[model samples]
Target: MYMVLVRTRVLPGDLLHDSYTGIAPPNTYKLGNKLFSLKVGLVEIDGKDVKLIPLAGPYIPRVNDFVIGKIIDFDAFSWDVDINSIYTAHLPAQDVFGREFSSQTHSLTSQFKVGDMLAAKIIAFDRTKDPVLTVREHGLGKIVHGEPIKLSPSKIPRLIGKKGSMAKIIETKTKTKLIIGQNGIIVVQGPSEGIVLAARAIHLIEEKAHMPSLTNMINELLTKEV
Candidate 1:
């Protein structure tokens, strides 16, 4: 049986020890007679067996997830993107940033080339094709660039919070527009100092995503001066 040495405090990549078996999960292993498990994840280490914790900002893109990406290439039917996620998100030609594609040429690379950033949402992921993304709605499109920072994709949902509570708080406090990508990237614009402070605050929230009262904590932190 798995021994519960420390209740549930294990961090991602933490090794769990079995009392009788003396072995642990392959990704995780135990040291002989050691009371505590080693922290193998990027951030912290915990000895107890706990829920799987994402080590970084959002990485995987679920359907309907809002994301920010850079346009790598544009075609008459679609736009190739470099979203921070594991897959290359695609923007259909019909969903082009502004209007339906008027270009007769199949290749739209001339119109939109590399390094064009946009705020979009994941609509669907077709295993045959790439993940389909869109920026065809209001509140979506090129984010006004200011200071760019990278974050883990996994931590995004937490930073956003339920009904966008966490994000709203940060936006209100920092007075900056924060755009998050599924691939661990974020775009922040507004006052330079405020953006930096907001980035730090978001990182903190990502680290504590599993906490129950994180919103309250972040609200307090954002309210305080940088």
Candidate 2:
């Protein structure tokens, strides 16, 4: 089995596997032993399973992707969250109530309601299925008092910087703690003035993510008196 991750743009009907690999994953179809892509996307080969990541469009949920979401609606079993994506995600009652989960008796509103903000991770997702979220990991849960900022998901890597250099500079200068969501949502926790400075730097990074060597530019921004 090839363990290499093949990351290349593939168009619809592109040949993915010539022989039996595994069941065709979402966005792909299998005809006998041959597999083919069903859409234009970036391909990822997981064991023998092929997965696609959209090249252009709104945010598509991927497992392990940390995201910030706002609770939009709820039912007896789960809370529906809007992660600035096409479909609303869900945080199940079992995820919150643990072994004692009982949608009939346990109140979902007592834990979260519409308009509540949360820091969660996508535990399960398929192009055809709604994303599933969980806050069981460390540093994941309700977003407390802080300034929330939004940016394009494509610019997340630049915001983090090489080895986190860019993010470090903003934190050191503003004396703030940053909670980053790969889905483009961010929360800056610090003094009011520091929060402003941090946000300024973040937006500057977004505007100039294509530019090389941003540390110096950020240094200048932080040093400039507001």
Candidate 3:
């Protein structure tokens, strides 16, 4: 029978498991009898499997990932958006307006022009093809106002904190509304001063995500700002 090993923290290139111990999962690869970590992350030993949870990495598009994008160009049926990824995302006109879209009569530019910002969902992506995006879902549409800030995609979870606790705290203390995209784009809306404060708080979170007592430190900083 297989046995579970104690949890351990590991860094990139660290030996995580051996062939006799467990099979590596995500962020780890096996070579010979040893499984090595591919990222700075936490390792979980579950029964006969070893899994790694990455703490840092660039944003990689995945299905259903909500993102904020800026319109860069448009063709007859689709618009290309910059979603802060290596691949540009395509938002089809039909996807934006549903199946009722009349391509023969409606002008795409009239509905969505260049430079428009939108909150969209990644519908599809692959290395061989450009990413696909859609704004048909609820609360996914044009972003008309607010200041946009960028942070490391890896730090998004930390900024959000556990169960949205840190995000709620930032919004409460700064009196702002935050719309965070998994791609590390955050739109801050509220009083101008509040927006600045919220942005500062988010930057602080991004800067110190790896440190211990981060949540408390952010809380204290917010208290001082408020």
Of the two candidates 2 and 3, the one with more favorable TM-score, higher being better, is 3
User: Taking the tens digit of each residue's C-alpha lDDT, what string does model 3 give over 111-162?
Assistant: 7899999999998998899999988889999999999999888788888888
Instruction: Give the best candidate by lDDT.
Output: 3
Best by TM-score: 3
lDDT of 2 by residue, 66-168 (tens): 9999999998899999998887899998898897898778999988979999999999999789999999999888886899898777677778888988898
Candidates 1 and 3 compared by lDDT, better number = 3
Ranking by TM-score: 3, 2, 1
lDDT of each: 0.67, 0.83, 0.85
**CA shift at 193, candidate 1, in angstroms?**
1.8
Q: What is the TM-score of each candidate against the true structure?
A: 0.65, 0.75, 0.88
Please count the clashing residue pairs in each candidate, in the order shown: 14, 0, 0
Query: In model 2, where is the ten-residue run with the lowest total lDDT?
Result: 49-58
Off by over 4 Å in 1: 1-7, 10-53, 56-58, 75-77, 97-111, 208-226
RMSD of each: 6.5, 6.4, 2.6
Candidate 1 on 1-226: residue-level lDDT in tens? Answer: 4433322455543444434234443234446644233433322324443323444332656788777788887655778888876678878766663464565744566445678777888889755657888777788876656666776666676777889888888888889987766566778888887898898887787667667788888877877775
Model 3 TM-score is 0.88
Error of 3 at 66 (Å): 0.8
